[model samples]
Target: MHAITIPEPGGPEALVWAEVPDPVLAEGEVLVEVAASAVNRADLLQRQGYYDPPRGASPYPGLECSGRIAALGPGVAGWSVGDEVCALLSGGGYAEKVAVPAGQLLPLPEGVDAVTAAGLPEVACTVWSNVFMIAHLRPGDTLLVHGGASGIGTMAIQLAKAAGARVAVTAGSAEKLERCRELGADILINYHEQDFVQELRRATDGAGADVILDIIGAKYLDRNVKALAVNGRLAIIGLQGGIKGELNLNALLSKRGAVTATSLRARPEAEKASIVAAVREHVWPLVAAGRVRPVVDRTVPMRDAAEAHRAMEAGGHVGKILLVP
Candidate 1:
């Protein structure tokens, strides 16, 4: 099988297209013939030699893909060969075929094409787990999502809004903010021109946001706590700004707030299975009902994986960037 891989980590230019060994299905796993895969910030880190796939996982960089089941492993039941599905992968999605644990596979929503379904799994699982599962965002609560036009951010805004929460988002430009607004964001802050904390406070009538989905960690940590409402919950899912920061414990205590940081990729298979199960139960219905849809910025070929990395690093996207395998 031909896969996109990094010979030596550096720039997107380092990604090479070449033949690699096809993945062998293991117990509870399924072999998927890849149709498409999506680009992620984690892929950028992996390409730069900063992030490594988990032990016994594929060395390839892709994190999510949509495909058809070509084969099923021992003990995998209820799904047949040729099932149209999209799956969350540990790695190896940037190839013609990928082996995924059965628990991580999601049936493609009715009416969604395979190429678009490829963009759903990672953002769906990531946003659903963080915003709803971990942070406990509830009806009438307010959520402040950083990077509103991002793949995860767009999904977060829609999900939070659909759940009857007021959604606020911060993007770098007016155009992106407008897009977030169209996606159901109630408050739009152009982070380049406005201070997010101040804007959030003002938008929430000085109460601050009840829940915050943050990608910037260190640089925004202190101010994030300051911008949090009483009893607020903050879920940190990325470290784009930096890792280390001075957090004011006093602010957290004053607001009676808490912060939870996590990543879906590093979780044990059982935990991911739980997340997938929850998503299938709760969020998948929204997709089926047409209340949620995959938002793709563009689709590129798998061989141009380097270009996808560069686009993500340069922030030249409003939604998911996909690669057709």
Candidate 2:
């Protein structure tokens, strides 16, 4: 099996595709013959030596993959060999084959192909867990998604809208915001040209957002609190702007808002399985019905993952970047 390996973390150039021994499946796990994988911002952090795979996880960078099942391990059931599926993984999706916990596997949504399914698991699970499961975004609620043009942001926009919530998104450019609007975002704010807090407040007649899916972390913490509606929920999933931030507790208190930060990769297997199940029950139907769909920026060869990383760092792509094995 050939997987992307990092001999020494530095830049995209550090990712090396090398022949590695096949993964050994454990109890309740299955071996998947990888069809494709998708790039995430976490992969960039891993390649730069800032993030390491969880203990006992695959050392490769990918956190999700789509492939056919080659073999199922002991205690695994309800799925068979040759089953076309996508899975949420802690690591090792950037390989020819990967071992996945059976619970984390999901059948490809109807009308979606293997390559497209590769981009579905991470974003789908992320949005479903944070926006619907945790924050409990209700119908008629206004949900604001930061980094609206990125993989998770795109999915968040569609899912929130599908659930009868109004969607708002912040993107770096007008073109990206336009793309978000096409995906059902009701309000699009160009972060480069506008203040998201003011823009969102104005769009909602100063009621502010009922929920905020934020990725910029500390840079937007204070403003995010200020931009929340009464009893609003804020789910912070990324720290792109740095880890530490000063929060106005008084402001959050006044609004009675809630804040939560979570990471999907470091969770226990059972927790991941639960999230996958929720996604299959709630999101898969929407995707299969074509009310929601995968948004792919482009596909690159697995061996050339560095190119994908460069493109992501360049910050021009609109959605998930697929890596075909």
Candidate 3:
């Protein structure tokens, strides 16, 4: 088998595709012959040596993939060899073959091709778990997402809109904002030129956002608080803006707001299974019904993953980028 390995992480150039020993499946796991895997921001961090895989996970950068089952491990049932599936992975999706826990395997949604399904798992689980399950965003609420052109951001916009919430997004460019609009975002703020706090407030008649899906972490924490409505929920899934920041407890207390930080990759198996189950039950239907669709910016050959990483770091793509093995 061949997988992308970082002998010493440094840059996109560090993602070297080379032959490696095949993964040996453990009990309750299955071997998947990888078809495609998607690039993520976490993959960028891993490539740069900032993030490492959890203990016992594959030493590969990818976190989600679509593939066919080659074999099932002990205790695995209800799925068969040769079944087409997409899975959320702790790591190792960058390879031609990966071993996945049975609980993480998801049936490809009806009407979605296998290649495109590669882009769904991470974004779907991340957005659904954080925004809907954790924050409890409901109909008529206003949801704001930062980095609106990102894979997570694009998924968040569509899912929130489909759930009857008014969606707002902050993107860096007009083109990205226009794409967000096309995905049902009701308010689009060009973060390079405008204040999202003021823009979202004005859009909601000063009620502010009922829920905020934030990625910029520290740099946006203070402003995110200002942008929240009373009793609002802010879910932080990324710290791209740096890790340290001061919090104004008084402001949050005044609004009765809540702030939560979570990561899908570091979650326990049972918790991940629960989130995957929720996604299959909820978000998959929206996708099967054509209410939501996979947004892929482009696909690159698995051998050229370095190129894909470069594209992600360039911050030019509007959605997920797939790596076909």
lDDT of each: 0.92, 0.96, 0.95
Query: Considering lDDT, where higher is better, how would the candidates rank from best to worst?
Result: 2, 3, 1
Task: Give one digit per residue, the lDDT tens place, for model 2 in 133-173.
Answer: 99999999999999999999999999998999999999988
Every model: Cα RMSD to truth? 0.7, 0.6, 0.5
Give a tens-digit lDDT track for model 3, residues 4-52: 9999989889989999999999999999999999999999999998999
* Model 3 pairs whose backbones collide: none
lDDT of 1 by residue, 1-325 (tens): 9999889999989899999988998999999999999999898899899999999999998999999999999999989999999999888888999999999999998879999999989999999999899899999999999999999999999889889999999999888988898889999998889999999988888999999999999999998999999999999999999999998998899999999999899999999999988888888898888888888988899999888888888896999999997
Clashes of 1: 0
Candidate 3 global TM-score? 0.99
- Candidate scoring better on lDDT of 1 and 2: 2
